[model samples]
Target chain A: MSFITGKNLSCIRGMKYVYGKVDFTVDAGEILVVVGKNGCGKTSLLKTIAGFLKPSSGQITISCADDLQSLDIIHYIGTSSSLKKQLTVRENLTFWSKMLDSDADNIDKAIKSFGLDEMSNSQISYLSSGQIKRCSLARLLLAERKIWILDEPETALDNDSLNRFIDIVTNHVKNNGIAIIASHRPDIWPDNKKLLEIG
Target chain B: MGAFLAILMRDLRSDLRNRAQFVMIPVFYILAVILFPLGIGPETGTLSLIAPGILVVSSLFASLLALEKLFSSDISDGSFESIILCPVPISVIMAGKITAHWILTGLPLALITPFLAIMLGLSFEIALFSSLIILLITIILSLIGAMIASLVINTGKGSVLLALLSFPLFIPVLIFAAGAIDLAIIGGIGNSIAPILFLCSLTSIALPVVPIICAAIIKWQVR
Candidate 1:
């Protein structure tokens, strides 16, 4: 397992200073929930950490004995659903799995586990918001990554869907994977999770 | 190779299923070409004189229409971020996306150019030759335009900025391609072949270089 550390992390987006001189660390087998009010740069913090946004001044170092770079082991999901609307749910899963270098059999497993088998062939545009959220999160199961960065993943999910979402993240963390979730509701997080509140 | 094919296949499926975006490229090229003869008198000599240049420029602008969405839609929908997180090199993924854009707009423009050329009063041999040049020219323009689009995708007025940034880079390739097609119109293998080879060499170099630069810019800007 690697130690993911951000030293003196300062991020600026456009003219606004998102965060200044912050530091945090996460080892394998843990979940860190980022909680804050609207417009508090929670998403920006996760994005900067995901390599989507460059920090104004800081360094994120992923340390391990292996020669692998940090990006090789991260799966970053943003606020919006990443599925293509025109393609069927199954097609979106298949394509992303293929892109992520996962095998075909796993696609079916993810579909079945996420309870999307019945609507697998339906186009994403036709699915409801909760269904779309499920389809989006189902993609996580298709690939294996050491670091998972999810931004507001509970957007439109119903209570049942939210439980399934929590279960999935808990299982991943239990298996020695690291997850950093940015959401407004930290109370919903599973037990034994770390909390980082920012404004 | 797997990552490249995965992006290509995914885009191919998306473009095939919802075709209004790509269909506009060839349709716009045809519409723009038709306006030239209508706007000018239908005189054979004058129309023939302008036909090759007309085809190249119309296709260039048509390619611009497609390039804006080449990165913006993915960027908005969060798929672009997922792509970055993949283990595969972002450059190879970008190359695949650019190639898919070419297949949709460039390849179709190439296949349709001969008809537009003949309609503009070019001869059978001349139209056939110019179509091949237009095909290569379209591919080259898409590569250049895609690079610019990647840079300006998140800006306030990105489409306008993309055009402003990419058009200057496009002018040189446009001049060479139009010149080659006009040389073909002048009817000689010796003079025309050299320019055609030069144009091909340009496309070949751009094939690798443009996507790699676009990928690097995209990665840097994400931060």
Candidate 2:
């Protein structure tokens, strides 16, 4: 019973309109992929929806079953990974899990879900970009958020890592979690996911 | 409460891991305090006379030194956005952060300033009293620093802008702290209470309000 609806949503960044009058809807147990050309406002739209950027003129509505603030239920991932290079993979993940302020049990589950068993002890600075991406993605599973607004989550991910990620999202969706992903790789995404294209 | 504790621990741990970043502030404070005596001649009378004002002013500058980095690293690394997304209010998170910052810079400076006061020819008793005064001043300055740090975190000219914004704002703390220390140096402990109590009032007001205002400014500017 969780859903996000946008009516007449328009986004402006520094006097330039990224998108205008775009409408979309996403519901529980669904994956909404935003596809668009470069600089055409895919990231802008996601940021606006995630509350990072305020909409210039529009209304983005959220309806949730548990009566929580829409922002509290969302996890936004931008292009830059929030991983600290000085800390080990486990350290970084543990820090994020603590910040998410959820059950500590999910910490172990997130580590396993990201397939980070071997590299858990390695410092993030030493890990490959793909491994780092996986660590960042693990944060989503660690915190139980209803909506995940991700910006280009596929960058630097390998095929195996991508599969693991897809499996994690699939499991999340099965549990009524929502994911709003902006990616250019349609081939990597599941075939049945909904698409929202911005010009 | 959970977010606040988590942030406080994280900040303390992060600072502990990178100890040099914080160590430099106190070192600079000592060095700055030592320089005044040499530049103006080491006459005990002159040194003791200016000690209260110089120490207070120098401490104010020391607080400004690190304010720029308070949120810049988190912002550049994208950790701040995560902090902002925490379920608790942003001001609470800032309270934790500002507390951690005070522990590192202001607390240490207060402890060491008594020793610095000795260089000014002040007696050990007044030095201890002056340290107490410094503790209060630093707390108020830390709160003001936290608010101004949020204001300038995103701008390019951060340190200069911080100095510009904070120098005028900190005038009252500097005046009261110097007044308290000067009174202690001249008229003994009893005479300094008025300014010290005034500082306490300022801190009491800033303790609750500054963080909320900082959070609001952060929310408005972060986008």
Candidate 3:
């Protein structure tokens, strides 16, 4: 199974500490919820794991069951939806699938799985913020990565959309996928997860 | 190859849908080129003599209008982060973006150069010949713009900063491209080969190199 572990991990930006001296581990089929006060480096820590930022000290390593490179098996969804507003839902998803070199079949499946069939042809700019968030989340299914790094994924999501998100993450973990989520609402997360608190 | 085409097509599709923005580049190019003749007087000899430089400089300014959006939009929308983190090589991804920028701004501008060239008292043959040089110079401008755009992505005044940074880098391209066209107009078509070959060599070097540099700068910007 795949696992990620951080030892005495610290993140510093602009000569100031965001988080420091922390250790955590999560394995396949597990979720790690990173919680903290605003500006506490929760996002920085997630970015560090995603290889977007270099940690000021310590190390975070990913060991997957397969021989794939760590970056190849990891997906990071940040606070911004990353969906192009000018394009329709299907267009955005299709672009991601192609960029990731994923199977073309997943395009329609992702649209259907996210309940975006009716809105598939609607431009993202016309959709509600919640709808836009759903379109971005559909991107997760476009690739077959082992690790998912999500930062504030629940923002702008409605109750129904949040439930859908939970289901997707649950299904993902059930299939031996690892999810590392950074969120303000730890209570809304699935029961099967570990918590890493930051300040 | 799939990832590369995907990024390129995605950008092209987006631009096509935004017709106003898509049309503005060439419209601006045309307007700017037309202004030179009006201000310089309709003297054919003077206009013909300076047509190459006028076309090159005006197109450069027109390109600046679209450069800010090249990387800053992706950064602001957070699409840039996802784009870089994708499975494809960063260079390939950036190459797609640079190509897309050229298509949206450069290609269209080149297509309309004949009309603009005629307005400046250039013959159809010389206009057609100069369009080729214009196309090459635009490609180089797009490459240089991509790098400068990525570098200034997070700055408060990205467009202003982009203009300042890209202006200096664009000087060499302007010289060769305009010089080539000048030779074609003043001398014979065959006489322009030296500068045309120089422009080609510059494009050859930039085609492969700029994307790598852009990739590194983008990673650094996000980091």
Best by DockQ: 3
- By DockQ: ranked, best first: 3, 1, 2
Error of 2 at B105 (Å): 1.2
Residue pairs in candidate 2 whose N, alpha carbon or C atoms collide under 3 angstroms: none
lDDT of 2 by residue, B79-160 (tens): 7666667677888888988988898889999999899999789999999988988899889989998898888888888888
Error of 3 at A185 (Å): 1.7
Model 2 chain B: lowest-lDDT 10 consecutive positions:
B79-88
True contacts kept of each: 0.74, 0.43, 0.78
Write the number of the candidate with greater lDDT, choosing between 1 and 3.
3
lDDT of 1 at B75: 77
Best by TM-score: 3
lDDT of 1 by residue, B1-223 (tens): 9889988888888887787886878899999999999999899899999997899899889888888888876877888778777768888989889888889878999999989999989998888888888888988888889889888987879878988998899998888888988887776545688778888898889988988899898876665
TM-score of each prediction:
0.94, 0.94, 0.96
* Worst 10-residue lDDT window, candidate 3 chain A: A63-72
> How do the residues A1-199 of candidate 3 rate in per-residue lDDT, one tens digit apiece?
2378889999878888889998998998999999999999999998888888888889777774232222677888988988888999999998999888899899999898888999999999899988888889889999898889999999998898899899999899999999999999999988878999988
Task: Give the clashing residue pairs of candidate 3, or none.
Answer: none
Model 1 stretches with alpha carbons more than 4 Å out: A57-59, A65-70
